[model samples]
Target: MINSFEVKETNEMIEKENLDVRTITMGISLLDCIDSDLDKLNENIYNKITRLAKNLVKVGNDIERSYGIPIVNKRISVTPIALVGGSACKTVEDFASIAKTLDQAAKDVGVNLIGGYSAIVSKGMTPAEELLIKSIPLALHTTERVCSSVNVGSTKVGINMDAVKLLGNIILEVANNSKDNDSAECMKLVVFCNAPDDNPFMAGAFHGVTEADAIINVGVSGPGVVKKALESVRGESFEVLCETIKKTAFKVTRVGQLVAKEASKALDIPFGIVDLSLAPTPAVGDSVADILCEIGLEYAGAPGTTAALALLNDQVKKGGIMASSYVGGLSGAFIPVSEDQGMINAVEAGAITIEKLEAMTCVCSVGLDMIAIPGDTKASTISGIIADEMAIGMINQKTTAARLIPAIGKKVGDKVEFGGLFGYAPVMPVNNYSCENFINRGGRIPAPVHSFKN
Candidate 1:
């Protein structure tokens, strides 16, 4: 029920506010592709992905042209490879071979990135999952478009300190291997607690077991659009400001609904949820931090930053849920340092710190993301950071993730340029104090008491 006036407004938003569909992701299930033989396993994985997503890019293009809307990325998410390739990928190199196949499939289909090179070890790890985790450094270093993620904790299962410790070392290894690209490989890797099933966003997207054989999920973003709406009420009350954001989010989500339905129909796949996340970009005017500034903060990490972010995230969800029957994924404000220009500025101005970012994540969509820390930061410190975020997610029963890049050979104040969507980041300082004893104690942190409900 998009009326003429709404259509015109959407057109204006696209032209002026940097509004668009961030991604049209096709989730393909690879459960049936499992084979005990490594060669056949890879062949099945490649064939299934290519067959289902062959027209994904083309359909996205047609939608963009027909509706005069921009579609930034076309992505694919598959079943966690640890489950699908467990029988076949007996060694770390075997898993890396499977990653190569995924990279090739992405290139063949002309998609921006392919996800689900992942494992779920919230409680404990199986042999296959351990193997896949071990291969992440080499796999991400060798491949171009493949993304990897590991879920080391969840509300129901608690934190797996063992997996967290291993991933800390693995992330450092990934950075070391890809130092030539300023640790670009780490940009494609995510460490998660309570990861979502139908996330269309990259670096953490994986097709959950509950999903259908194939589906289409769209992630729509417009932080700039929200910021523009807020501008119309400079001196307004908090209630008025919240209303403005809700109305703007409603309008933005309707456009997403249109794109999702059209893409699903065109592809003959079931229409999955439309993720109403206000995902920011490196481009000017499209930042969650800027939206916070519009809320009267001098800089992003000013005193009231966390409160502003909470309001923005909650209102966006309220508006979006009313606009569409289905709203899921990390549908809130994202505060990735490298991807948001205002956040980058804040870090450079010394207004934002890693600790402040951690506090912000208590209310935002995800945890510390695309943050580059000094190269000398120890693996134990990284694990400590992950442990803290995981504890937050577990206690809050929300999805949180960390994509930390230990910029090899770089120190505080040095800049790491990853380019493109990965963007660039200044090396932020980490606490020099040691958390070695805590991380070295390898065991599961017990699940929250509320999780025991039957």
Candidate 2:
């Protein structure tokens, strides 16, 4: 349905507003690369990834130049490594070797990051999964561009409190290991509830086993464009505002669909879904929080913030689904504190809190993303936060994730700088209350009664 657009219309959106494809990710399944020998497994994975994604970076660059649109990152997401390495790997070193191979493959192909160094423990952890999860701190610390994720809960299955508790300690260990760089390694890890299979976003993406051998997925972003559109409808009713946002999102998602088509064609791979997530950057105009403020909120975490975010998220999906029939992934607005300037500003002010962000996540696509907490924050407390968020996603039947950065040697009000697109975040305060007892009660939290709709 996307026909040729007027040159003037396209230029206005690209040059004036921050409209661009966020990522062109090639999802390469490494399932067949599995081997019972650890060394052979690593070799097979590296070969498969390199062979499948050889032209990924060049293709993305070509698309960006030919279309005059920015394609920010070229990435790869492989089959979840826990399953792939289950037969071969035994100890933490074996898992880390696979991570090393992934990192090498990413660099070899000129990709920015490679995801799927992950474990899906929603039901429970196997011996292999437990080893992979335990090795995450070392794997992430040693590898430059390898991202890891762990799925701890879902609607069908209950929350794995044991995995949640272990991840809390693992997060702290990762932060402590990379403290000199402001816990930069922690930025590459994520904890998810109801994790998506086709997400093109980093730190949480993995090629689900259900997917094809190789496919191309695109992520589109245009918060600045949405904000600009809202400016024309200032003081309008909620009905008018929602319609305007939907129209803007439609146009934005169409761009992503076009890019996905081009990339799939050029790479000779199947065209996967276009992820219509409004991913924000540190740039001033490109921010989800700015859109929230334009919707009549004074700040991002104000009293009505949750309501505003809910409206925005719903309208975005409505608009995007109209533009692309194959829309999948975590397709909604992201609220990473470090990635959005408005969110960082809100944190610097007293407007936002950890608890407030939790409330907002119930409406947003992801939960508690890129938030920097105090160094001394207890592992039990982090697990407690994860439990609450997992509960939200399971009950609501949506995807939610946490990427908390424990800023070592920094307390509330201190700044931890990641620079570049990661931006900087002021270490936010956490409640001093202990949740050790609750976290220590390590067992599965049963699925909600409503999940029995069979």
Highest lDDT, which number? Answer: 1
Q: How much is 140 displaced in model 2, in angstroms?
A: 0.8
Instruction: List, residue by residue over 1-454, the lDDT tens digit for candidate 1.
Output: 6689888999999999999999999999999999999999999999999999999999999999999999999999999999999999878999999999999999999999999999999999999999999999989988999999999999998999999999999999999998877887899999999999999999999999999999999999999999999999999999999999999999999889999999999999999999999999998999999999999999999999999999999999999999999898899988999999999999999999999999999999989999999888899999999999999999999999999999999999999997776678999999989999999999899999999996
Error of 2 at 287 (Å): 0.9
Residue lDDT tens for model 2, 92-189? 99999999999999999999999999999999999999999999998998899999999999999989999999999999999999999998889999
Candidate 2 versus the native: TM-score? 0.99
What is the number of backbone collisions in each predicted candidate, taken in the order shown? 0, 0
For candidate 2, the 10 contiguous residues with the lowest summed lDDT are 1-10
Using all chains and alpha carbons, the TM-scores for the candidates as numbered come to: 0.99, 0.99
Error at 321, model 2, angstroms: 0.3
